[model samples]
Target: MHELVVTPLGERRLVLRQGSSKALQLPKARFEELRTSGSSAVPQWLADAVQARWGMDVTGRPVDDVLLLREAGPYAFSRATWELNLGCDYDCVMCYLGEKRFEGLDMDGKRKLLAVMRDAGVIWLQMTGGEPLIDPDFPKAYRIAYELGMQLEILSNGSRLHKSHILNLLRTYPPTKLTLSVYGATAETYDAVTRNRGAFHRFSRGLRMAIDAGLTLDLSLIIVRGNAHEADDMRAWASSLGLPFREYANISPTIHGGAETLPSQSPEYLTNRAPFTGCPAGVTFFHADPFGRASICKVGRDPNIDLIAEGVEGLVRLGGIAESLMLRTGGCSGCKLSGTCRVCRPMAKVFQEAKAPLENYCQHGSR
Candidate 1:
């Protein structure tokens, strides 16, 4: 494995070190030069920059030894998020996925789907799930993505992260980011929220194990009704770990258009969001479900294109799908308050489909 990766991201180019989000921008001409520089020694400037930035000395190394290039393709997507499976050990009520069904591609199908993603120009990939660590096929799939030259980020609940095998896998091929969601500060509250007894103990054990392994990690502090009282404790705990954390308070309807997760939202913790702006979901990135169904984003999953059947050619339709989903249509058509809308079009559509309260999503609430 090369110490550095150089990949084309849409029209942009980046030089990234594995296990780190920080990247150094490369000019398109410079990128192309390196791609064509076969058997050439590492450039003096690049070696110096890499040494200064990442403290890795690549002065006398061959170009191939130091840099791994992920070639761009005719296909459009530069980033993608793939669901390895929808199976979880702990059932969190506030999960965006309404039903945590154990379904998705088998090992063979997973390999094919990841290959398609790579050929389609997906340089940055996020492997997510109903708790990706619990999936039996996770280790191989994770390794596959890494070997494919995709910068990976794993979204996990941290329940099974303490497992020796799991840690070994992660330690061998570190992800660019490993984001774990923290439900509560205490064991009792944590188990109560996830409806899994002894979950907090396991969660703590996983954190310690991951830290001891010297793995890079980020925390998502899930602020919900059950854990709202312990908000300060959660923040303090994250600070104590010295890991960067982000708070998620505005719980949305599930991807299945169900209102189940909204009630768990903590009203006091709710933060006002900026007005809706245009998004580049299908244009720049897309979400792939367990079965390899590609959608504009996670929330806008319908009218999907099957990646297995169509391959990268399926992504051609995604731009149109994204365009159609973003337009103000149906009940929202001709709305004069669109400028003041809080959420994006796809998100609004999900809330509308769920029959969520008007006050939760609309400016023209019941008067």
Candidate 2:
């Protein structure tokens, strides 16, 4: 379909993509206006802005409302995340994979998995890690996904990105964006957080090289007690490099069932709350682990269906399973803290000991 697709860009903005590559960014209010009016005529101001920024001439281009709304539909699985492998070169203290060995599909198996994803209507695919670049078959898999017309994203620690082979592959079939996880702004704090003596230098070098190569890059700060003090510095560093930056404070239990890296919630972070309305996991998005085991998300990793065996049909069937999993169960049903309870089914399963109003999560409870 040669129609514009709209996706949310954070809470305040929306991104519109047409065909395989062209895209335009619009403010939430302007996007709402277009959605409600269903007007084919593009406003002169918006058209000029798009042309000036993205160099797309949409002066009188007709916007396909039906296609746009269809993509924006709640049931659409337009985006998917693939954990390419659970292996990494660095052993960060806060690693979610924790000691999990890499068990991803081989080259042939990955191709089959990509075909299934394409059939399942995933247009935007994020290849993540332990370290996606370290996966031996990543280049071929990445090229295959690009060939299948999927917008690609890579999440890495910037260790192998500077390698000539890796740089060449990226140049050949560049991703829409590459997100690097920055632990700290300085070497001392970075090494302390990552526990790799020369990691900071390598990460800095690789990130600089990639930027110099003119690759689209972004940064995320993994906020934890050890590196939280450098949050401002990290943001400043990203800003100095003219790159986008985001910070994440919450830490879930590792895939290996270890909570050693789960940090104490800061008072400011603890004030934020999630609504009782169920999460958009299996409903709109899904995650496949290294071995092609599909789950709603990494944290809520129950009901792991083997996507390799069941294919896209199996992914469709996960909706019912997801609904079942969302039901409030023992110690969760009608709890006084339901309004503010951070515990979801998968999280309860992760920390079974804290099933009943986790003391650490409860703001009223003593820390």
Candidate 3:
């Protein structure tokens, strides 16, 4: 079947690809028209624009366009985040995987896992970690995923990306994007957060090299109390680079239930609560840990099933199990605070040391 892949580039721009050969960036409105009205309704100007840019022969491909547009239906699992390993070189203060032993799947095991994901219809795969680059076999695994036609992404600190071998691998089989976490604006503050001397310098050097290599890059600031003062500077630095930047404030407990990295949230910080809807974990998204244990989301990891042993079908089966568990248990059930409560079943499971209603997460008093 012909596949027309639509990927959002920015505010109103989108990149539309036909198979792996032809791709062109067009306005979102035109893409929507093509999506809803089929290829026959495609404006003559739009067709000419695509053909002029990519030199694709669209003379008698009307049927193919219609089929491709219609192919954008729901799949069992469309995207996945695989934590290649929990190992990282720098010790960041706010890291989630605290002192957790790194146990990633071997090369052969990773190949099998990728095959399972492909069979399960996952089109987008994000390779993340404490730092995915730390994995020795990451390049081979990444190449395998690229060859399998998965739109891939990597989340890293950019410390090792400047290395010749790593850069060569990235240039050879480029990922869809690379998301680098910027700890702080300056070397002092950045190294303070990382707890490693000269880490900021390494990160900056690697980031520059990656940019020079023409890798698509995005940056995020992991805002914690330590670097809260430099938030503006960090944002400004990211703006200087002209890359997309985001800030994350909410700090969850460590993935391994270790000591809390950041301090407890103030009552004022907890007061302004947004409405709680269910997260798209087991349903539409899944996170696989180093050893192939699959969870609904990274923060809401629970009832984790071994994906290596049970395979993709195991994940599918666990979705219902996870959903049922979330709906019935924890402080979420029939609680008035559910509207404003940030605590979900998985969070409750992680921080279950306290009583119900999760006073730390509730704007209202705990029940």
Q: Work out the TM-score per prediction.
A: 0.94, 0.77, 0.77
Model 2 stretches astray by more than 4 angstroms: 1-75, 263-271, 353-357, 364-367
Write candidate 3's Cα lDDT for 87-131 as tens digits: 888887667687856787888889888887766656678999978
Instruction: State candidate 2's TM-score.
Output: 0.77
lDDT of each: 0.88, 0.74, 0.71
Clashes of each: 0, 0, 0
Model 2, residue 228: distance off in Å is: 2.9
Which pairs, if any, clash in model 3? none
In model 1, which range of ten residues has the least summed lDDT?
358-367
Write the candidate numbers in order of decreasing TM-score.
Answer: 1, 3, 2
Worst-scoring 10-residue span by lDDT in model 2: 65-74
Error of 1 at 270 (Å): 2.1
What is every candidate's alpha-carbon RMSD to the true fold? 1.8, 6.8, 6.5
How high is the lDDT of residue 190 in model 2?
90
